[model samples]
Target: MFNYAESIASRNTYMTSIRETMAEAQRSKPAVTISMDGDADGKSHRFYTNRDRLEGDVKIVAPADTRFDEIYITFEGTSRTWMERLGVSPAASGRTSVSQTFLRLVQPVNEASLPIPRVAIKGQEYTFPFTFVIPERLLPGACNHTIAVENQSVEEAHLHLPPSLGDHTISTFEDKDDLAPDMTRISYAIRVRVLRKKDTEDQPVVLADTARKIAVSPSIPDAPPIHIQDRSTEFVLRKEKDLRKGLLGKKIGRVCIFAEQPQPLRLAPNSSCPPSTRVPVSLTFVPANAETPPPELGNMTAKLRTSTFFSTQRTSYTPTVSRSTPDPFVGRYQESTLLSSRCVSNVSWEKQEPPLSSSSSSKPVYKAQIIVPIAEPKCKHLVPTFSTCFVTRSYTLELSLSIRTSKHSQPNLALKLPLQVSQPAKDSREHDSAPQDTSVEEFFVPRIISPSTLQQEVAVMAPPPPPPPPPFDRRQGQLPQSMLLHPPNEMPPPEYSVFRGTGGPPVRIPPPVGISPGCG
Candidate 1:
């Protein structure tokens, strides 16, 4: 897996090298620089949400009298995907690729005010200031293919502008690399080109071109909970595992775990501090005999599974991104990235009393509410849940619990639950709805990359978590604003029968109440 990601990294780096070479060659010409409004560090990237103003200025410097036809500046968004077909001959694993330029905003640059000659004056500088309102949604043409929207006849969800995805070259915060697969890339750029008019039969020549990359995660309202009923394969809301006495002793009772679909993880509008919800879990223990105390609780941990579904053709049915092995079929391709894990410590299960109609020895039940984060703030570049005609991105929450049943043997209780990661709708009247950093620089030049091939890899390891907030009090139902933060501490080491192991693509670490991910 390391080698796989390494190969991808090397290939992407090679692409960067080629682009850099081209950019270096262009540097000798008249320079065109772009300066945008907000950035935390002039070195990092800028992020935007729905309807934010992407205001910037393009400056042109001419060392000599440069002739030009027109200035072309465009804000463009594009998505590209390619994959080696599964059944292709080993010697010729030809790949099929598809790309779409979905968003293009070209508000004509008003050059009439600055009356300058067709040829620029020698050693002169010119600045064309501009402002583009980031639209609330994309045009209908953006997703013209057949699509499926929950409870809607028309495909409305995919028409909204998807967040800039797959490009992880720059990050403003300590967020992990989105672990996006090379098969899919969604990029947005501000490209400035100086064109020279050509003869009647020839196309215009591009004298100078420069591209500035921007990262955007539009404000996506919380979607209705995705209904998942498949019990055997994709989603298992309930499961039973056997518990034992000592290694040599007879079998003890069985532990059954079950949970209803929890509320969606609500991502707040402002990017700085997003909130997550708790998952309510119930456990029932049936003793083999009469005297079996509840199996000791070892540890509880949560994982986030991000499944990206892409298609070369239009969809006739809503593709349910599954957790089972990938289908060998063609046209539809999927990639699941498991981000870094977060240790949920100190999960206290509240004991539940038996019903009057049931016998005391019938069964024992316990309940606990475990919390998780929408997405940890430590890493940036985490795109929210969204769907489109060509591609769809979704998330599933995998919870695992460790049980100290006996000295020699232990069993784990785990379940796969559907999770929604979404942002609250903006009121349009609130100031600072989408927060921007103060220390923005002129521009951070991003390399424009074309698709390239690489071997596959999925490797994950949990990183240390952020600082924990103050102790939470659940009864109040109102958490102190200051007591909300990503939980602190490292994941507990693996034990016998604890979990399925952690060597895969890192999953996102969700939090409980305010800081931790486990029940308190």
Candidate 2:
């Protein structure tokens, strides 16, 4: 008689025992730690793309008998963005996203095989060092891809493509952004993984894996010298009661504003300017009439402002109706102030009286020199200036001057100037000459290791060079000296063959026959 129930119970117990043993072994496995050289003592996760070389070490802590199938580290740059719809019904919702990848570098890590192959034992702790270079040109994202046509039509449809068709091509890196938290995001990260070989039918398993976020920003170049001058039209201090009446209000004197600098202002990419750079500016206020005195200049201020405009078109498909319809392209605009200069407390006025003999009159002139300082943004949501079918960012320099007219009322004058910010041109020498800052080192440090211990580990893990190849044997009948010294002859002309038919063997034709001397 066969007892099937008892047999099944015994088999179940055996399988459970096997699983327990495997789990226990995994728990006792050694830990893996990774760190980069030159990272800040407190912050060791961030890295940059402009770094020339990145060096790091991997440490494995395991029992004396523990073994590893493979050990290596990989460096990569990744960019991802997506959008989701909100609202009860799909018909009422809209979609928006940003795509850009200014920097991307991926280097395949070369693994160092164990001497015994698939067997590694560390009594205490073992470390392996690796180094790689950051490439000057990053891998182009699909977003930067363009199609060439002899002639292309300019139409709304042609300018905008649906996300489904353009998603793959939307590959470009831009400054990090957290705007539209529910709508879009851009980021970069470095990931490390370790694998362990398995003896069972199950595939090789990952023993340990970790990832860290990295910030990538365009480098700011030195600003160039710039000078600009403009004059305002005369207008009344108060608003007119009617368009037909021209003399309803008192007239305020016309004013001229002058600005000059020794160098052109350098704008950083994505409207994010560095806090260390400053723009030197000189302003002169001149009244329209030489007889009129210049208006008293009160508090004066300047600021850098950015405006972002975005547009998108959504299409809906109805299965029952067997038709597709698209909604009109909608646009949204938002403005922000990035940097502001300190207020100018006061301005000195210089008066020039008329000459004793001449009848010409002179007006008072107000002059002031102030340095405009740039500061970092208050939030992390700032993004570089960019323009695409769906999004565009623009910047401006705004200057406001307050005028003291009477004891009770003071009028304010405002001016807006368009500003352009960009990275250095590809051919510019500044890219190569830019000084490297140690604060943005491209290395990661494990949290568990101390500074002294890390230095010792790196020193011990340095690899030694292999021995030189054996010397060549001269007695083994080397090439003759005459042959080695002989000059090479001219190359022979290429031979030509003609095919008679498709998929047929080629037919060789001899050189055209020539008449003999006697026959000629």
Candidate 3:
């Protein structure tokens, strides 16, 4: 085997001569002299040489066995790089073991020592051709997996990962005679490269750097789906499809717009789903095409129920729109000046109660009422004039009803109430009268007529039927003939203001009993 030991002496000749002389004295060997002999034209010089002077030069040499095992662990400069091989020998006990528990190496920064791969002995070194075996477990409890050694002499050249300066931990075994305890264990990161050709004068290019460390444990676990609710309607398992339905042939995709009160949830289907628990929910749904509403759904809404823990639960259902048509009415309210005047004096229409249906359905049904709020007018002249006296002349309101159906089969009723206002009749005392000539005082008689008689007179002067309907095109061009001015004969003859009184001038009668003037 080729010896890989580094040479100790340099190639300087002067030092070699001095060493050879000293070697002779130490070995008690024979010494030689030098002389010079002159020739015919030139002077000659001679130097002494030791031929076969084995003992003289040999004594100065250090014995190959003399502490050849001892190593100073010397570093060459501010930065150091060294490679070492270790071998084990048995100690006095005959059992081989790592005799040292603690080892030391130098590094400027403590963190830089973890990557070195070799170890050196303090007092001994070994030649190449030795294999070092280490115990499987040592300092087993230490948390760090990597060990390193470093040279701290240079401030900037501290040892680091992949430890260029040979930073690594090693174990030393005791020798059999307790003599050669130079063996050590070395830990190192594997360095590799690509080479072109063997034996070529060139360097291999580094491909990659890798650190090797011990390993210990196993791997970590996925997280779980969220549940939401809708307000306004009670529903369960409120999903995006709750209110979506297809039209004639269009497919309606379901969509749920969750409010911001709850955090935005993302369902990573590849990962995991959220938990299904009661949660505070403000969710809403919209038709796939908002501009064109879903025709299948009617009166759709969401009802949400909240819990004390701020969780919400919900259920939803759609109500239908009314489809029933209302009954048509062509009847007219006659503009009767007297009969209308009479009815306004004392009569009123009360609201009728809605009768309960005999069905066994539990759904709530709404009942309605109609009331005629009438303003009656007061009259003082009819007290003694007629058996049934006029109390007040006022306008009143009348309400009419019709029913319609919703698409969800719910009832949608229509209501039309006509509002009417009556103006108060002018007081007879405020009329302006022309000054009468002092010639004659007109004589007048008080004629008495009953209510029955007044009714008879009003029936006789009624107007004729309206003219035949005009063509649609012509009708559009003309105003209704009913609104046009009529002939004097067509005008209903003015009926008597009072059936039993002569119109000589309203008599200045005294106010009625228990009646104060201007009380209205």
Which predicted model would earn the best TM-score?
1
Model 3 residue 26 distance off true place after TM-score fit, in angstroms: 46
- The candidate with the higher TM-score, 2 or 3, is 2
List TM-score per model, in order: 0.68, 0.49, 0.12
Best candidate according to lDDT = 1
TM-score, cand. 1 vs. native = 0.68
Off by over 4 Å in 3: 1-210, 213-255, 259-282, 285-520
Candidates in order: C-alpha RMSD to true structure: 31.4, 19.6, 53.7
Model 3 collision count: 50
- Report, for all candidates in order, the number of backbone clashes: 18, 19, 50
- How big is the positional error of residue 303 in model 2, measured in Å on the Cα after superposition? 2.8
Encode model 3's per-residue lDDT on 52-84: one tens digit a residue: 010110001221212111111111111111122
lDDT leaderboard ranking? 1, 2, 3
Give all candidates' CA lDDT scores: 0.66, 0.45, 0.22
Off by over 4 Å in 2: 1-30, 40-42, 45-49, 61-72, 84-88, 91-112, 115-126, 141-188, 196-205, 214-249, 258-291, 306-345, 349-395, 418-520
Q: Write the per-residue lDDT of candidate 1 for residues 27-53, one digit (tens) a residue.
A: 546788888776435433556677777
